[model samples]
Structures are given as structure tokens and as C-alpha cells.
Target chain A: MKLEKLDPTVKACTSLVCVILLSFQYLVSLNIAVFVLSLLLLLTCTRARGIQVLKLLLPALVAAFGLFVTGYFHGRGTRAEDLQKIAAMPYAVRAAMSTGLYPALQISTRLLAYAGFGLLFALSTDGEAFIFSLMHRCRLSPKFAYGILAAIRLMPNMVREFKSVRLAFRARGMQLRWYSLPPVFTMLVNSIRWSQCVAMAMESKGFDGDAPRTCSIVPKLRWYDLAFFSCWITGILVGMCLLRY
Target chain B: MKWKLKDILMIAVCAVLFGVIFLGATYAGGALYGLLLPLGMPSLGYEPFYGLYFMAVAFAVYVIRKPGVGIVAEILAAVIETLMGNFFGPIIILSGFVQGAGFELIFALTKYKRFDFKTMALAAVICSCVTLGYNLIVSGYDMIALPVLALMLAVRIVSAVVIDAIVTPRLADGLARAGVLGGYAVCEGVAKDLDC
Candidate 1:
């Protein structure tokens, strides 16, 4: 990205990048620790930081509350302290349960982290530059990468169209009943047409039939990206290595 | 009336939408599962509802009412899925073939005569089996009991019906309304087909 608009895009791209990177942490406790740190990073960084953080906490809270309620009513409120009481059951199941929660937590964190990053990218990074990065650094063919990226950018509009079409039907006095399917079906067909129309328009404009193209903007990985990435890895490694107790 | 420019665009768009759904689900599902296996989950898995991918062929054939189009749509979807970084890597290509065929069989039974509710359900059912068979053969899920298989089958059937019967029909109708499905007799007359 040009120096003018780099900060936000890199941040946004990283969330997805980080999640993709997150798959590497499948071995042990490091995964959980990394996920927690990522959640923290996303909270501080995203524009709607307070609300975003709250959104993150909501699910975990829900899960924990559900777990607590289940244990309270069903398991007599099993707690960490009661580990000794249920000591008769085999260790593997217990171990697995504890580990299971960690992954779930991390999974949500990774997902939200990507969303935040997406926000950062959408808000800051120039879309063209970002696509260029994948083309240049990642070696993705410029043609395919840009074509798909352009298509993906249409996703929000597609979803919105879906909503409006429903509204349009309702405005026309059609009720959206379970058995009623025509109007909704028509909308689906229309969506398909829109894409093809766009594809054709692009084709007419020489977009789909090209071998490859070049971009004026090239993403240079700056000191900030390196710094943030290093800190991210170091936190996870330290957390994993030191928390062995 | 003949196939208009809008009709061609619409049908192509529907085809792409189908591709997107399949690719998106597979890519996201596989990535999520892959990530979960390491950081937190080593034991369980999600509800396995993307199992609907297995029935793509049947869904395509039923709605599109063309022989090769169903197969092409599924394969294209799988390719998109891979490009999106589906967790299973290249194997997704192979899965697309058998799963697409599973749904295709139901249509073949009616000899491609109709896209009626019964045929649609049959397509979904056969597809569910195809996916289950795939999971049993290639996927490493341990066979627990008759009950587990039964449960999985039930979930799969419900999902397929919802997808094929409800979602697919609505889409077919929309295209038909927009004059997109003019060439396909089965998908035609949506205003009369559901008798809306």
C-alpha cells in the first residue's frame, strides 16, 4: 500500500492472515494463549473498539453462563474446586473437556479477530493495493486474484439485495410463508442474473478474458507490520513456554 | 419466447451463486475444523451440516433440468472452494463428483420429467446417502452405533430438504420470474408451478 493508507489495510488483512496462521497452533496450550492475545489486540485496534470488545465477550459469557447453568442444574454446579469429587471418572475425558473449551474460545477469537482485521482493511487499505499484495508477495496470479476479489467485494451487495428483494415482495402484499416460495425463488434467480450481467459487462470491458494485469500499487511490508507480527508470535511462544506450570 | 440476454445472465448468475455457496461453505467449514483440531478441539466436530455439499449435484439437476449442467455447476463450485482454500485441499474436487451424482440419481429416476416436491425430496435423500457413504468410506469419523448413523442421517435429510426443497425452489422460481429459466420446462411457469 502507498504510504498514505497502509495502516488500516494491513491490520485488516492480518486478521484473516492470522486466522489462517492460527491453524499452526494445533498442538497444545499455545493455541489458547495466542487466541486470547489476538482478541486483546483486536479490541485495542479496531475502530469500534469498546463495542467490538463487548461483542467478543458476549459469546464467551454466553457459553460460560450456559456451562455454569448446565452444571448448576444438571451437574450440581461443577467447578474447578470439585475436580476432586469427580476424580473417579477417567482422566482423559476430563482432560478432553478442558481442552475442548480452549479450542472453542480460540475459534471465536480467531473469527472475530479476522472481522476486526477485515474492518481495518476495509477502512484503511486500498482494495487494489491489497489485491496487489496477494499477487506480488503471495504469487497469486493477478488475473484470478483480482477477479475473485472483485466478486467477493460484491458479497455485501448480494446480501443486501437479498434483503431488499424480500422487502420488495412484502411491499407488494406477498406474505413470506413457509409454503410460499415463488417470490423468494424469483429473487434467487435475479441474483444469479445480476452476477452474470456483471461478468458479461466485465467481459465486454475486457476483464474476464484477459491473461493477467498489473497494478500500480505494490504492498511493501513495513516496519509496523513486522513489529506487530513479531509481537504476536512472541506473545504466543512466551505464553506457551512459560505457562508450563 | 426465446432466451433473452437477461435470461442467460440470470441462469449463469444462479450457476455462480451455487458455486459460491458450495465453495464458501466448504472452505469455511474445512478451515474452521482444521483450526479447531489443533488449538482447542481434538475430539468433537461441528454439526456437519455442510454435508449438504454432497447433494449439490441433485440440487443442480433438479433446478436446472439439464444433464451436464448439474455436473458442471458442482465441479465449478468445488474449484472455487479450493481457490478459497478449502481445508481438505484437492480432495474436495473428488468429493464434488460423487456428491453431485448422488443428487443427480433422484432426477434420473423420474427420467428428468419434473422438478416436483417428491422428486426434490428424493434427490435430497439420495444425496444424503451419497455424502454419508463418502464420510463412511473416506472421512475418518468412527462408526459409533446404529443410533449415531441414524441421527446423522436425520440431520442430513432435514438439511437437504430445507436446502433443495425450500431454498432451491425459491431460487428456481425467482429465475423463472425474471424470465431466466425460460428454456428449462421444469423450472418454467413458476407463477403456476407453485400456483402462486
Candidate 2:
């Protein structure tokens, strides 16, 4: 079944669990498996384009490589004894027997696994569907859910305002540094004004924090959500057990 | 305390703004990390910008002056960041929660009254510590050498204090003075101070 067709809440929950569990486990093979499987699922089950997935993975790849180098050089167990042990090993085995090699691989692969799960949920789930699901199934307060939804809708306008503010500054012959505070402050002030107006509009429409409300789009939990969740969990558990032995 | 619709929207918009900033910081941090990779302490790169992450909590709590606003703002910011395609993924939501709770603990201890520099600085320090502990476990910072780890912690705390404590309160107060935060608790506090 298509992962896009699965419940967003379920996908999010699974991805969160996967990330947490993967953090604790340092098994290189398991991490590689999880990363590959997540990528495969994204490519096959979800409508996420291969290029899109690659774009998402690019940062993770760069980070993983940097981490590997960091761990190799500054990682724990780089003492004299560890160095001597590595030196004593045969030439072919020396690289593999380096003091921090194992930990480096573990850390890098774990990062990849995390990115994989993150991309899985992010690419597969629609933001609106996820929010509505939280409102319907997770019982999130309408106050916050709708508030967040409204703010999400305003994001593009905020970006546009940010650019216009910068242009306004430039038009005045003022070159604002990237870390300049005035632009940010201006944006914050504008956000406050906009939020106040939006809030007033919403309140005028009888938006009440305490009042019960009906939703237009309600995402349901299907049998496949459970099936996929259990299958994913069992796969990880089995991989862990087999790797341990 | 009852949260008005205005309070909710204010937090939401501020969170969205900060989320965008946080995403930009992540890219900046990534570049710095790559540059510092040769120093054998690439982890320190991100430490300096750690304070920017807590601005949402600091700004929201200071303006709203309510209990639990920091946590809500932070988590919302994280959700927005994740939706914006953060490279760190959904797990950042957990980091957001931890960072928010760190500052919230300080405000809670003050009985949600103080929004002063001392209080914010203390909150920033506590937030640095809390998130540091989290990274030690989740990000595998413990595997790094002791000296580097200590250095990272120090840089992170200093960054947090500068950004969250120094910059955020001043910006919020500036907004308050500009009359944009008219009906909020910050303006009320400012008026109360003038009466004294």
C-alpha cells in the first residue's frame, strides 16, 4: 500500500519512534538497513520524486561525512594505547582497527538513519492532513490547531513582507547586514500587528477556544496504518535481535 | 491563565518567523561546521548559534507573560521548521520541547512574573545545559573527547546568553515600546514600571 495513503498521524508516530530508537542503537548494520529501507519506501510507496528525496538526503550526506571525519580524529579512545594497538595490526587491518573507526561509522550511519525516517514522514504526509488528523484523532485543541493553520497560511505573506522590508531598507540607501536587528524587529512588529488583526477577525467570526467545533477534513485510521506500523516495529526488533547474536 | 485568541495567533506568527530564522541558522551552522571540520572540533560550529533556537521561547514567554507559553511556542516553531523541510527532520520537535522546557523551568520558578535580564540570562544558561545533555545522548556527543565536549558546552552557554537573554528581551521590549504590543502583558508591565 502507498505510504501516502496511510494516516499521517501514524506515519509521524512511527517516524518519531524510529528516530528515538535509532538514536540509542549504535549497530552499524541496523542503521544501514533502516536508512536503505526508508529511502526505498520513500521512492516506491510515496509520490516523492527521486530528485526530491536526493535533495533531502544531500545535507544528511554532507553532515554524515563531516561527522565521520570528526569522530575519526577527535572521537573518544584516541589515546596512546589505542593508537599502539592499531599500529600493531596488519596493514590491511589497520584502517579497520583504528581507534575511533567503529564509533565514527556508527555515528555517521545513525545520522543517515534519522534523516531517512524524517524524510519518510515529511515527504509522505501532507501538512494540512497532519494538522487535521491531530485535531480529529489526537484531540488537539481547536484553539491551537486552527491558530497554527492560520499562521501556516500566512507564512508566504510573511516571507514577502520580509523581502519588502529589506527592499525598503535598501531603497533608503541603507545596507542591512544579514545579522541586522532592525529588519527582524520590523518583521516582529509587523507580525504582532498582523496577528492582532487576524485574531480580531477570527474572534469576530465566533472562534472560541472553549467551544466545540466540527472539522471539514477528518483523517481516519485505517487497518493498513496498523499493519504498516506493526510490520516496521517488528522488522526493527528482529534486526536488533539477530544483530545482537 | 486563559489564553486569548490573540495570544495564540501571536505565538503562532512569532513561531513561524523564528522557524524561518532557525532554518537559516541551520544552513549557516552547517557551513560553519564544514569549515571547522579541519579543526577536529566541527561540533563547536553549531554551538555558537545555539541561542537563536531559543528565541521563540524567550520572545513568546516575555510578550505573553503566561505560563506554558514558551513550550507551546517552541514546539509550534519546531513543527513549522520541520514542515519547512529542516534537514534535522522530525526529531527536532523533541529538541524544541527540551529547549522550551529548559527556559520554562526558569519562568515557572519566578512564578511567571519576572522578565528581566537576570531571569532571561539564567533561563538561557539552563536551556544550554538541558539541550547539551540531550545532545550527549541523542547526537552522540559523549563519543567526542572530553576537552572538546567541555568547549562545546561553554560555547553553547555563551551563545545562548547573548542571543536569548540579551537580544530577545531587548527586541520584545522595543516592540512593546513601539506600541505594537499594546494589549499584551509586556506593555502592562512597562506601564506598571513607569508608575513606580
Candidate 3:
């Protein structure tokens, strides 16, 4: 029942299928159905986490609305089918909303689907475990895999560093602009220094590419992973076959 | 190219730094795009803002001056962003891979020797083109008019050139001048073994 137990590759593959299915699908009903299914899955996994992801979706929703409006206003050359759909509306209203309906729907729904699947995978999966799976199961070289894991591990410290860097700027009576280049520049300098130190420390500790290592938490594909894959793929395939604009 | 531990650690750090920046840009761009939607401009309004996305990888490759650093930095950044609860989720990993490959491919084309502004600009343009293809697939850009698409592409290319080519290298030069990047490839001619 805990989706987190599912193999990351399985979750990743399912998410890909969901994205592809949503991208190709234009029917609002199908998109809504998949969205609901995704929402259910997310909510069932962890209510608090699901709420957090929904909070994240707010901006995406805003962006999708923009895309919808843009598609409606400037999409140009309404399809004949769309024209027939708009044939009955008032001339003024129809002119604005006519040709763009399909496009607007398609773009907005695709964004929703993207956000939904993104939530499912990002919320449920553990980054360290995922990297472990990548190394053990996905045949990724340990150098790249461990490098990425190190980056992920360093994220919290990086955030703290970003704040300190800003404060250091302000301490000198210099105001930092959000869009300015100085903050990022300082961060990069700091990061480069830290990376060198970390690297040197790691090397001194005998870490090397040729060394064989074992994982603390081994990733395994359980029956639920298979079920998760089958359920999502079936839903997506069925939606693709049955749903049309 | 032998990847030393420092090299790998450098990639991780650069990727994390850039990933954080990318996260900030996403929110800022999203808010800006939302603000512009009520006006008539929809897609084009956000294309120029997209240059921020290229800053991390461009700066990383410039400083690192190695093959595959672009891909490593990018994909690592995406992983960090995902761990930070990015709204785009795991697909960002795929986006990072595609974008990094495009960036790395251009440097590869140049045999990894040229870190000139022109090469950086070219690589940025190539990366944007690849991202545009990705947009067409996921965002349904094919549904829009050709003129709009052309305009968007043009703006994107210009943005890429300005941010990735001009700004990133300038920033790297600044970092080098500050003596933080003592042993980096960018700082090779300046000094042998300065304190980092």
C-alpha cells in the first residue's frame, strides 16, 4: 500500500506513460479522469504530502491558465471540427473562443497531467533510494550516481549557504536584487570551493571508481511494483484507445 | 579525460547551486507568466524569461572545462531539484538529461577546446532548440501559428546568447579573479596552486 516501497524505475516508467498519454490526449473527459485517478493515488499515499504537492500545483495551474488563454487568443486557424462546435455561439464570443478550444484544452490538460505525474513520483520516491536503484538496477556508473547523490545530500547546506551569501552582500551595505547576477556568482564561487574540499576529503578517505561498494538500503522490485506498473499502464493505454477529442 | 574526485565533487556542487537557481527561476517565471496572461501576450511573454534556466549548466561547463560536465551538472541539478520537491517532478530529470546532452553535444562538436563566447552562444541556441522540440511534444506548440513559434524561438535564442554566453562567462571570470577557482581549467594560466 505504501507506494514508496515500489521500485523507483517502476514509478518512473509509469510516470512516463502517464505523461505520454496525457500529451497525446485532447479529450477533456479523459484528462479529467486521469487527473482524478492521479489525485486519488497521491492522496492515498500520504494525505499531507498530497496537500503539499497540490500547493505546488497552484503555480502550474496559473501557468496552465495562461497557456489556455494564449492558445485561445493566438492559436490561429481553427480546425473545421472546432469551427462546427463554435458555429452556434454569438459572433463576438465565438471569435475569441472558437479556434482555440482544442488547443487550449490540450495544453492546459497536458500541464495538469504533467504536474500530477510529477507529484506522484517526486512525493513518493526517496532520492537516495532512487539513486541506489539507478546504480544497482539501472547500471549507472557509481561515479555519476554517487556524485548526484552527494549533490542531493548537499542541498540543505546549499540553501543555508545561499542565505549567508546574501547576508554577506547586505552586510557590506549592498542590496541584492532578485534578478541580479551577483548572488548566483557568489554562490558559484562558494560551491566550487566546497566541492574541491569535499572532493579532496573523499579522495583522502579512499573513495575511487574501481572500488566495489554495497548499498545500505538495497532496492528490490516487489510484486506491488509490478502491480503498480500494470495498473497505471493499463489505465493509460485504455485512455489512449478509448478517448478522443 | 580522467575524472578525479575533485572533478566529480565540483560537478555535484555546481549542479546543486544551479538547481537551486533553476528552482527560483521557475517560481519567478511562473508568477511573471501568470501576471502577463491577463494582457494579450501569452507564450511569448515567458520565452525571454527562460534564459535563467541555462545559467547553471553554462557556468558549470565554463568553469569545469571538461566533457560530460554539462550533462552531469544538469542531471545532478535536476535530481537535487526533484529532491527539493520541484513541481515538475521526476520528468525534470528527463528534461535535464535532454538539455545537458544538447549542451554537451555542442562542446563535443567543438572538441571541448573552445570556451569562447561564440561556442557558448551556439551551445545555448542548440539547447534551446532541443527544449523547443520538447515543448512541441509536451506543450502542444505545434498547435500554434508559425509566426508565433518563430518569434518565440528567436527570443529564446537571444535570451540564451545573452544569459549563457555573455553573463555566465563574465561571472566565471569574476570568480576566477576572486581566486576561488585556483586550480580550475579557467584559472590555469593565471596561477599554479593558489588557495581556494
Best by lDDT: 2
What RMSD, rounded to one decimal, does every model reach? 10.1, 3.4, 3.5
Q: Which ten residues in a row are the worst by lDDT in model 2 chain B? A: B187-196
Q: lDDT of candidate 2 vs native?
A: 0.81
Which lDDT tens digits does candidate 1 get at residues A145-224?
A: 54455555555676677678778888999888643545446556556556556756766776542365655666677797
DockQ winner: 2
Clashes of each: 15, 0, 0
- Which candidate, 1 or 3, would have the higher lDDT against the true structure? 3
> For candidate 3, what TM-score does chain B get against the true chain B?
0.86
Model 1 off-target regions past 4 Å?
A1-32, A46-48, A56-132, A139-173, A177-180, A223-245, B1-157, B161-196
TM-score of chain A of 3: 0.84
Against the true structure, what is each candidate's TM-score? 0.50, 0.92, 0.88
User: Candidate 2 residues B1-196, lDDT tens each?
Assistant: 7777788788888888877776678789888987898787675677888898899999988888888889988988887777777766678888899989998998999899788889999999999999989887887766677787788889989999999988888877777777877777777656432221
The candidate, 1 or 2, that scores higher on lDDT is: 2
lDDT of 1 by residue, B12-121 (tens): 34444555555455444455445544432211223344444644454456555765546555654554454443333234545677777777776666777778788787
Best first by lDDT, ranked: 2, 3, 1
